[model samples]
Target: MDLETLLSFEWGIMMPEFIILGVATVMTLLDLFMPKGLKRKILGWIGFAGILAAIVSLIGLLDYPVTTILFDTFRLDSFAKAFKLILLVGAALVMLLAISYEPKEGLTEYRSEFFYLFLTALLGAMIVTSSGDLITLYVGLELLSLSSYILAGLRKENRRSNEAAMKYVVNGSISTAITLFGVSYVYGLTGTTNIAAMREILLALNDSQSVYLLVISFLMIFVGLSFKIAAAPFHMWAPDVYEGAPTPVTAFLSVVSKIAGFVLLVRVMLSIFANAVTDGPNSTSILLTMEDTIAFIAGVTMVVGNVVALQQKNMKRLFAYSSIAHAGYILVAIASLSLFMFDSLWFYLIAYLFMNLGAFAIIQTLTEKSDSEDSSHFSGLYTRAPILAVAMAVMILSLAGIPGTAGFIGKLNIITGALVREQANYVLVSVMIATTVISYVFYFGIMVQMFFRKAKVKDPIKIPVGTGIVIGVCAVATVLLGIFPNIAFDFLQAQFYEFGDFLR
Candidate 1:
C-alpha cells in the first residue's frame, strides 16, 4: 500500500484534529509576544473555544461514519467518537480551571504554554481513540505522554514538582521502551505492524509457544498502559506526581490519559483477541486466553490500587490512588471485551471524567487558601463555600458509586456486562464486586471529612469564577449522566457495533 494512501484523510474525519492544531499554534504565538496582564486569559478562552470546536466537529462527523479510516490506520466507529467527546469535554474543563490557577501556581509567565501543551495532549488522546494500526497508536501514546511530562514540570520552582517530573519521565520512558519491545516482537512474529494483520498471524499459531508469545506481548503492552492508568506495581510515580503536579494536570492525567490508554486497549483487543476464531489441533484459543489474562490483571489492579490508596493522607495522593481504582474498573470492561463492553467503557469514562475532574478542581480551588494538602483542608468546607462544597460532595458520592449519581450508573453497566458474561467470567465478576465494595470505603472517607467534620482552622476560601463555573457544570453533568445513563449508552451503542463487525 502507498504511504500517501495510508495517510490520506476524508477531511471530514480530520476536522477535530485540524481545529486542535490550528488553535494550539495560535495560542503558542500569542504566548510569545502578548502583553502581560489579563490578556493571557484570552489564551485560556481560546483553548476552551478550540476544544468546543473539536467537540462540535466530532458530533458533525458522526453523520459520515465509517468503521475504519486512513487505510485502516484509523477507525471512526462509535467507540472512538464516544471517547473523543469525553476527552474534549474533560480537557476543556481542565483549561478553565487552569485559567484561575496559573497565577496562583506561579506559572504566570508560561500560562499560554499550558494551553499549547494541553491542546497537543488532547490531540494525542483523540488520535489514540481513532488509530487502528499499532504503530499509529504507539505514536499517539508517546505524543500524549511527552506533553504530560512537560505539564507535570510546569511548576518548576517547587521541589516536589521537579521531583514528580523526573520520576514521571523516567518511569514513563521505561514503560514506553517495554511497549515498543512488545510491538517489535509482534512485528517479528507477524511481519506486519497493522493490528488487524497481526491478529490473523497470531490466530494461525497453534503450539504452546504461541501462548507464550501472546502472554509476552500483552504483558509488555500492559506495562505502558499500566503506567498511563497508574495501575499498581507500575503506580509508584502517581502519588508523588499527583501531590506535586498542578491540580488541573493531575485531573487531566486521571481522566484523559486513562481514557486514551483504555481506548487503545479496547481497539487492539477487539481486533486481535475478540475475533480470533481458529480451528486447529493443539490451538490455544485467542479470545479465551486474552480474556483470562485481562481478567487476572483487572483483579490484581483493583486490590493493589484501593489497598494502597487507603494509606494516603494527602488529598491529591488520595485521589491519585482513587484514580487507580477507577482504572481497575475500566479494565473489567477490557476483561469482558464484547459488543456491550465498548458501550460500557465509553459510558463509564464519561461518568469518570465528571467525578474525577469535578473533585480535583475543587481541591485546586481550596488549596490556594490553605497551607496543607491533607483532607483536613476540606474541614468545614460545608460551612465555608456551601455551593462548591455541595458540588464536591456530589462528585465524591458519584465516585463512590452511590445511587443517584453518575459513577453508580457507570459501575452498574460494568457489573451488568460482567454478569452477562458470567458463565465465562465468573471469577472476574466476583472479584469486581468485591473491589467495588472496597473502593466505597475510601471514596466515602473523603466525603466524611468534607461533610461531618467541623473546622479546626478558620480561613475563608476564594474561588475564581472560571473555577466555580467549571465545577458547577461538572457537578450537573455527573447528576445528569447518572440519572439518564441510557441516553449516553444509546448514543454510543449505535457506533460500538461497527467494531463487532470489523472484528468478526
Candidate 2:
C-alpha cells in the first residue's frame, strides 16, 4: 500500500480501463458545457471510437504475463483480456445502434446522456472481467447495474420506461444486498477479501460446519447474482424491462450484461467453492455437491423461458424469454464442469452476441416503422425489404439452433459438454433438447411472419447506415463462425490455453 510500491507496479496493462474512464469523464463534461442547440449525435460516434480504442489497447496486453496490481484487486490475465475484447466489441456495436435509433417521441433532450451512460456501463463491465478481489467485483457490478437502471428509463416522457426503471432498481437493490451478504460470510470465514487467498484458505477447510457455511454462501451468492443473467427464479424482471427499454439497451442487457454476470459467477464459484472439501471419508468439492441445484435451476429456466415465449405476441417480450433460455443453456455448461467449460461459454457467448444483437436491430427497424411491438408487424417483410428480411432470417435461424448456423454449433458444444461429463447428466441434456424444440414454436413464427405471411404494408423498410453495418457484420460473423468454428477456438486456445492462469 506504500506510495513507492504502488508506483512500482507496472500500470501499462490497465490501459483499456484507463482509456474508458478518461473518455467517459471527457464526454460527461462535453455533454454539460456544449451549446443547447448543438446536435449531440456526434457524441455517439465519439463513444464508438473510444470503445474501439479501448479494444486496441486490450489486445496489446495479450502477450503480457498475468499481472496483479492495487494489492491484487485488479488483474491482467488471458481470461480478462479475452472477455474484455468481447465486451468492447459488443459495446461498440451497441453505440452504433443508439446512434441509428430514432424514437417516436423524437429524442432531443438527454441525447448526449444516452451515449455516455452506455460508455460508463461499458466501463463497469470491463472492470468486472478484470477484478481479482470480491470487493472490486461488487463495485464493478453495482456500477454496471446502476447505469443500466437509468438507461432503462431514459425515455423520460414514456410511462412504461419510468415503470421499468422503478422495478429494475428495486429488484437490483435486493440482489446487491444478497450478494454482499454472501461475500461477508466468505470474508468472515477466510478472513480475506482476495479470491486467491480465499481459495487457498478454503482448501484447508474440512470441518462439517465450515463446509456447510460454504454451501450457504454459494447458494446465497448464486441466487443473488442470477438476477444479472436473467435466469429463472430471479428472471421475472426481464420481460417487462425488455418490453419497455430502448431496443439498443435491451440488446446490451441480454448480451453484454448477461456475460458479465457469468464472469462474476465463474470467478467466485470456480475459485473458493471449488476448493472447499466436505468432511467424512470421501472428500468432495462443495461445488460438486451443489451441481444438482445449478442443474435444476438451469432446467427450470429453459422451460419457463421457452414455454412463456410461446404466449407472447410482443416482439421484445418474446426475445426476453429467449434471453432467459439462453442463460439456462450456459448454466448447463457450468454445472457439467466439463473440460470444455470455458470454450463452450466463450464460443456460445460470441455466437449469442452476433445473433441476438442482429435480431434486435431488425426488430427495432420493423417495430419503429409499424409503431407496434406485435409479432404480426413483421408480416411479409421479405416482400418489402428482401435483404433485411434475409438478414433477420439468418439471426433467427442461429437463435433457434438450426443446423449449419453458429447457434447450432454452440448448442452442439454444450450438449457434448454434458454428455462427456464424468458423472450422470443425461436428464439435463434431455431438458435442454426438449426446451430447444419448444422454442422453435415461437422462433419459426417470426419466420412465418417474414417469409410466408402477406404484407401489412407495401412500402420498403429503410435501413439506417449504422444499423446496416451492425446487421451485415453480425450476420456474416454468425455464418462464418458456424462454418469454421476452429478460427475462434484457435484464438481462444492461443490466448487463454485452458484458462490456467485463472487460479495461479
Instruction: List the candidates' TM-scores in order.
Output: 0.93, 0.98
lDDT of 1: 0.79
Q: In angstroms, how far off is 158's CA in candidate 1? A: 0.5
lDDT digits (tens) for residues 331-414 of candidate 1: 888777654776787788889998888888888887854445788888777887788788988998898888999999888888
Candidate with top TM-score is 2
* Residue 450 displacement (Å), model 2: 0.6
Q: Would you list the C-alpha lDDT of every candidate in the order shown?
A: 0.79, 0.90
What alpha-carbon RMSD in Å does predicted model 2 have with respect to the real structure?
A: 1.0
* Stretch of 10 with least lDDT, candidate 1: 495-504
Error of 2 at 294 (Å): 0.5
Candidate 1 colliding pairs: none
> Model 1 compared with the native: what TM-score?
0.93
Candidate 2: regions farther than 4 A off: 369-371
